[model samples]
Target: MKPGSLLARHVAPVPTSRRWLVPMAWFILLLMLSAGMGQLEWLFRLVEPDVREVIYRRAGFFALLGQHVMVVGVASLLAVLLGVGGAIAVTRPAGRDFLPLVSQLASIGQTFPPVAVLALAVPALGFGTLPIVVALLLYGLLPIVRNTLAGIDGIDPDVHEAARGMGMTAGEVLRQVELPLAAPVIIAGIRTSVTVNIATAALGATVGASNLGDPIIAGIVNGNTAYIVQGALLIGLLAITVDSVFERLQPASQA
Candidate 1:
């Protein structure tokens, strides 16, 4: 056999585990294309000035995007903290009775419509980003809390018994054994919350927080499909990109 054929025969088929690379590459390409579209005005003047203005100048799509990200990021962080703590609280023997109640409450928050949340929050919190943040945080809480509870509860009982038998304190077992094992599942919950909030944060523009939704709302007022598509595409791309980054950050052993 030729040297190439011999090498191919001897080397076990190269593992196919790197499949994520293909999607990651495609995602990067799409992001670059979106960025170019976002800045199309500088490249071509043939497009009508008014259309260019609508795409770039009037709406401040990039600025609005940044605001939306900040709002979602802050809200997601807050939701994770609250959800994790709440999960821990309700899991203890003394707090066990309240677990279902807390879970139901969080579920209620998630079920509430973002638009309705915005409307109610705006009246009390007034304009700007506070109302938006509150709405997003509330809406994002359930998944994190539910996943946290599931992760902690799903641990093998034998492991817990072994930890206790080894004279480990409750806090030590939780900090060292339980949390490390549960980290992957908990992170999965956080990933879900972050992605969901990214889309929901667009509702902020309805209450004057100024996000990518600005163009979509304006487009509806003027019956402009292009404007709506541009805004929706940007928000959708942002969610996918951020979720991809988070997935990459997850423990490789778990993946």
Candidate 2:
């Protein structure tokens, strides 16, 4: 196939609306549950018969879900921009010398657990969403950086020559040729980063961030299984919904 056709292959054969059906379904269910948690009291009561209160009501579920999404969304956005930009920069001749240092730092970010990052950050940033965002951003960077580098580096050198031979400028080669071909891999990295951060964001509750994690932490503290179940179920649903969206975005060939 021609280089141009390679980019087209990333588009799914499914219709646009049809492609999103699965994610939309999951997202709707999440909204229903968050909005109507009280309706599930019988379900939770079965899970915790002895408990006086089976539902978590310190704060609204919908509000906590919004807080959770906001934290992960902000961190994931920052991670994608920095990770993709840095990867592209280091691959260029002018920035090649810094590649090793950047790679090492990204690796360190992945190796250190999010909880530890939170612990270190809380003192400096102080308890709240700021530290959680920073922790999630750092934690999410490695996958994106690694995959972006791998995607760009894996491109055949002949493709670059072919594009340049056609009078494409350096920026044009990157934008039209490099990024398009690399999109599948880069998207896969972002998918992983976002999903993992969704689950990890729950730890924010320990640091005073009012998120879905709040219920889980409170459940543990109060020995309330129902609360833990509610929080975990929502987080799992959110992750699955977001993951399905990314899966649709990825090229079928790569998937």
Candidate 3:
């Protein structure tokens, strides 16, 4: 009935359901595009008027998409486990001395570049998904480890003391207090790690991993602009979809 109520009604915050809907829409669009890429031949033909074959038919889009997701998923999972575990361990009394070493190693891992890691790993692992996964895992560790360390170390000393004074065991304190408070920062790190890996996973095609990057690589080799567009478009859509999913999860992490 008042001016404030009218203003509040006009400027309402978006509903939580609506926030999740965006990512769902993107995911559905990605699936639809992947399944129906052949249907868009005319569109690609416009882009590459000279090419006899505009559609990428060496492998199905869905299959390549799955491979891309799998590669990123496996690598990200391993990075999270190792990064968070190492960060937690280093923060403990017995492992404090190793903190600097672990941090330095993580920094080095990120700085060394995934392509270089792939070059080194492929020789020993001999190509395929293993080397790609290993490279991605190594490349993705720094963000998760750095964020986990920051989150855990940034906790107030008084809070830890209070948690201990409340008769909470060390394990319980970590599980209940430290981790809960740190979840948002940790999730942010994971989000960054995952999105970056999605782009990096494209490199796997060179090593015979067979992913969304296939089109781009093939296009480059054959000088087909259409194929490159297809690969780049799908990769962009996939990255946006995944990043939106993380956006939806961010609030949950904060809570």
Candidate 4:
């Protein structure tokens, strides 16, 4: 009966001091990795080498970093579109008949190994970014689809009934109520998908995709621990940065 109850129910709760924390932390993390990498040289050399080695200066850090981002970013975007869209579709009344089919198809990516996907795709797509992109895209779909299905389907039946009783159209209920309520869960799915793909995308370098994995693969091939440490450290930092950003991005209730 309160004037603001309806709005309050739908609006995401955010803490004032912490509302800007996630973005600021992400920016600072990126800035430190970008600008302060040189000052951290000793950390990259802590691993014992089989032979004397120089720092990994073979490729520009930022360029490889950029390419890595592009590979995972494109793949994640595609997965979100396909995964979320598919989940949304199956949850709808008209599309309920195909829910089983949609779910099974989404799971194939998880069951199939990324390496296998790349190996198979390379012949069709050639060796470059495309195969790996396809691999990452498939590998990342399971979480997104699973989480989306849970979020939307888990909504309280009363909420839908209330919306319908109020004469809200199906589209309006979905837009105004269902998605906002489910967004945090959906975002969590995306976070899982993207974070996993960041590590998985490194495999792209094995297929000549030129990501952070290049140093890692090269290190393995040459027995240079420094190169391995360098690549592994950067990839680890990148994962932490991405995870932190998503942590802050979660809905307040979810957070």
Candidate 5:
């Protein structure tokens, strides 16, 4: 028998379980370790004697979590609304002349540093969450706007023509057809906005808005590595959790 024929005859298909076992085992071990670390009250107390007081009595940790959520949520919401609207507007024939200009503006907003935007806004908005929210919103707009434009523009022109030929009103077609087909792409943009905003919102603490960044900045000032690690771990876990939840919500078809 030929070598090639002999090999093909003897080779057996690999099981799916074998393919997935290593990665799944590692992930499970990592999760167990992280949970154990998070639950180690004694370790936390030794590292930061005020951990319980800050997390519970003073409500600093929860307050920080809330601020982070609020800034990211508000900024992401504003970005989605403006981005979707701008995408629809620029797709129209009448708005073609302005598409490049609008896209350039959004790109500029993203290229400008969040810290710089926050610094500029502070004098006008003062020391609070407002400046942070504004900076996050500006930072978040480009991805959403670009994604929205691409989703809408990527739709088949023939589909639009067919809808019109069938006596479907422009509004009806857009509401029933375009938006649904583009939903996956738009949601992807939202996911990106959310993840980016979560990280950027940490900058708020620089302007005196309490957030996860508070611990990080305080740790830096006092040279406390434990505090920095604790804050970073919490922030990273929060982002991962939120991202995982969103991933679960996505349709299998989209995935």
Candidate 6:
């Protein structure tokens, strides 16, 4: 078959065992990271001997992980909506004039450092997860917006013309033709946005949002290497697992 049928291959059913493996592995890893960090309690006691063995007693590791996912999840959802929505709007004839402005705003949002955002936001929103969510949402927007715009714009004009020639309305063409062709690209953007935020969400620890970074921060404050290692390990694992899922979902064309 020609390369045109590649997308069909992309949607081919994954092995039943393989489909379950990723989620099961993800959950097992997640459980280990979130709750398993406590298993190091004995190790901490052995090393410290005198100091507070469990400096990370503020919350269980699993609790912090849940908070971490929550913050990143909310932020990524908002970014996807705003990013994809803005991209679609600007691509349309009615909003074409604002394309430059939309692109520029997303650019600025990404370039703006999370720390600076935290500093500025804390005064208005006060501490907690809200500011971090806002920061991550803004930071994560560029990829989705840029990818959406690129995906939609890269569509062959002939395909759109063919759709229109078939007596399809603009809305119908977009719904049935434009979006399917653009989906892979748009999803690529979403993958990037979500993956990046998973790491970035750790910044919430600095602002008292309390995620995986808690251990790292506490470790740093107390000069305890064990805590830092625990936090960093779990966060890294989470990133890798999530990125792997995205990798699987990525279209063959993206390859």
Highest TM-score: give the candidate number.
2
**Can you tell me which runs of candidate 5 are displaced by over 4 Å?**
1-41, 44-59, 252-255
lDDT by residue for model 5 (39-97), tens: 65566667667543222222245566767788888889999898888878888888888
Please report, in order, the local distance difference test score of every candidate based on alpha carbons.
0.77, 0.93, 0.90, 0.83, 0.73, 0.82
Q: Name the TM-score of candidate 6.
A: 0.88
Ranking 1 against 4 by TM-score, winner:
4
lDDT, candidate 1, residue 212? Answer: 82
TM-score per prediction, in order, is 0.81, 0.95, 0.93, 0.89, 0.78, 0.88
Q: Write one digit per residue (lDDT tens) for candidate 2, span 145-216.
A: 999999999999988888888777899889888887888999999999999999999999999999999999
Error of 6 at 149 (Å): 0.4
lDDT of 3: 0.90
Off by over 4 Å in 6: 1-12, 42-55, 252-255
User: Candidate 3, which ten residues in sequence have the lowest lDDT sum?
Assistant: 2-11
lDDT of 6 by residue, 161-216 (tens): 77677777888777766677888889889988998898888888988898998988
Pairs that clash in candidate 4: none
lDDT of 3 by residue, 168-226 (tens): 78997788788877888999999999999999999999899999999999999999999
Could you give candidate 4's per-residue lDDT for residues 97-205 as a string of tens digits?
9999989988998999999999999999999999999999999999999998999999989888887777778888888778877888999999999999999998999
| Model 2, CA-based lDDT | 0.93
Task: List the candidates ranked by TM-score, beginning with the highest.
Answer: 2, 3, 4, 6, 1, 5
